[model samples]
Target: MSVTGAGAASSTPASGAGRRVVILRHAETVDNAARVWQGHKDTELSETGRQQVAAAAPHLAAYRPALLVSSDLQRAAATADAIASLTGLEVRLDARLREVHVGEWQGMHADEVRERYPETIAALDRGEDVPRGLTGETRAEVAHRVGECVREVERELLPGETAVIVAHGVSGRIGATELVGLDQDVSDVIFRGIDNCHWIELVESSKSFSARSRWRISGWNLGPWRL
Candidate 1:
C-alpha cells in the first residue's frame, strides 16, 4: 500500500441500491512527487499539485457532491477545499480518513525503504500486509477505520446525493475497496493503487438495506485528463 503509483488493477462498479460515494485522493504532495513515504506526516501540496487540483475542480463539480469530507491533513484539506469551492459545499474533516501511519518511514525516500526494509517493501509488492515499520499499521487496520469513516459519512447523505471523501492514495484504495466489500484475499488483484488527485466512485441505490452490500465501483481513476 505504501507503493504510490507502483501497481495496476482492474475494477468495475457493481450494482446495488444507497448513496454514490466518490473517494478522491489528495493532490500531489512533496513526498508524492519525490516518491517518499508520508504515512501520517503532514506535508503540504506542491505547486504543481495545486494546479492539478484546480484542473480537477470543474470535472469533480459535475458530480455536485452534496457534502465534502476530508482528512484534516493539510494536503487533503487543501484539495478538498478546491473541490468544495467548485461545488459550493462546506468540508467536514475526519482524521480517520488519514493515511496509514507509517511511523519511522514518514519522510523516507521510496528507494531508501526498498534498500533498508527489503522485506517490508517485498511484502507490500506482493500485496501482503506488513506492519514492520516502527509503529506502522496494517492494510486491514487502515481499511477498518476507513470503512467506518465512510459508513458514518453515508449516514449523513440524502438519497441520490454524493459525498466526496478526500484522502491519501493508500487510504483511497483501502477505503474504496472496503466500501465495495472487496475481499481482502483478492484485494491485491482488484486494485493496484490510485494516482494523486484521481478518484474512484462507488455508487449504491439509496434504497439498499445495507451499505456494505450496496456499494460498488461506479467509476475508477477519474479526474481531469490534464491532472
Candidate 2:
C-alpha cells in the first residue's frame, strides 16, 4: 500500500509551550534488503544504512532537542550515535523502544515463513492469535511496551524541549498510532506495512498527543526491507 504524506510545518517555532517529539526509524540493514521479519533479533546497519543515518544527521540537527533517545538495539544505537555526533546531544538508550519481538520468526525470511506457516500468516492478517515462535512477543505485548515508552517520553518532556526517539519499524508504528489516539483498526491498517526510516512527528503535552496531524516529516526507511 502507498503511504500517504503529511506536509511539513511551514516554520518550526524557536520556542513553544508544547513538546515536539520526532520519531525516527533506524536506517536500513542487510535483513531489510532481504525482506525478513527481523523482530528484536539484533542486526547491524548495512553500508547504505550508515550513509542514510549520516545524511539524516543535518536534518535532525535543526530540531536541537534537549535529549536524543533511541532503542538499545545496535542498529538504533548506531543511528543515535551518528546524530549525537552531529548535534552534540547525549543519547539515552531506552530498551522499551526496541522492535516488536517476532519470537521464533526472528531473522527468518518473510517468504519462507509465509510458505511454511501460511495459516499463521493468515491469522495475523485477521488479527487472531497464532503461535508466536520462541522468544517472540505478541502484537498486544508490543503495544504495551511502546505505550510505556511513550509515557517515559512524556514524563521526560520539558517546555520548549524536543526529544528525538530512534526506534524500529513495528514499535515505531505502534508508538505513532498510540500517540495520535488512532483507533486500533486504523492504526493496524496504517502500520501493517511501512518502509524503514519512515519519519513520524508527534506533539506531547500534559493534555494530548497524536499521529493524525497534517504535518508530515520525511521518515527514514531503516529496517529489513520486507517487514
Cα lDDT tens digits for candidate 1, 193-227: 67788888777755568746777676777765634
Model 1: CA > 4 A from native? 1-18, 205-211
TM-score of each: 0.87, 0.81
Model-by-model lDDT, in order?
0.79, 0.71
Locate the minimum summed-lDDT window of 10 residues in model 2: 215-224
- The digit string of per-residue lDDT tens for model 2 on 1-227 reads 22434313333445656667777788888888888888777888988888777666666666776778899999899888987997788899989999887877887898888887787788878976454653577777877888788767866877667777888887887777766556656667655544555566665444434434422323423221332
| Prediction 2 TM-score vs. true | 0.81
Q: After superposition, how far is residue 181 of candidate 1 from its true place, in Å?
A: 0.9
TM-score of model 1 (CA atoms): 0.87
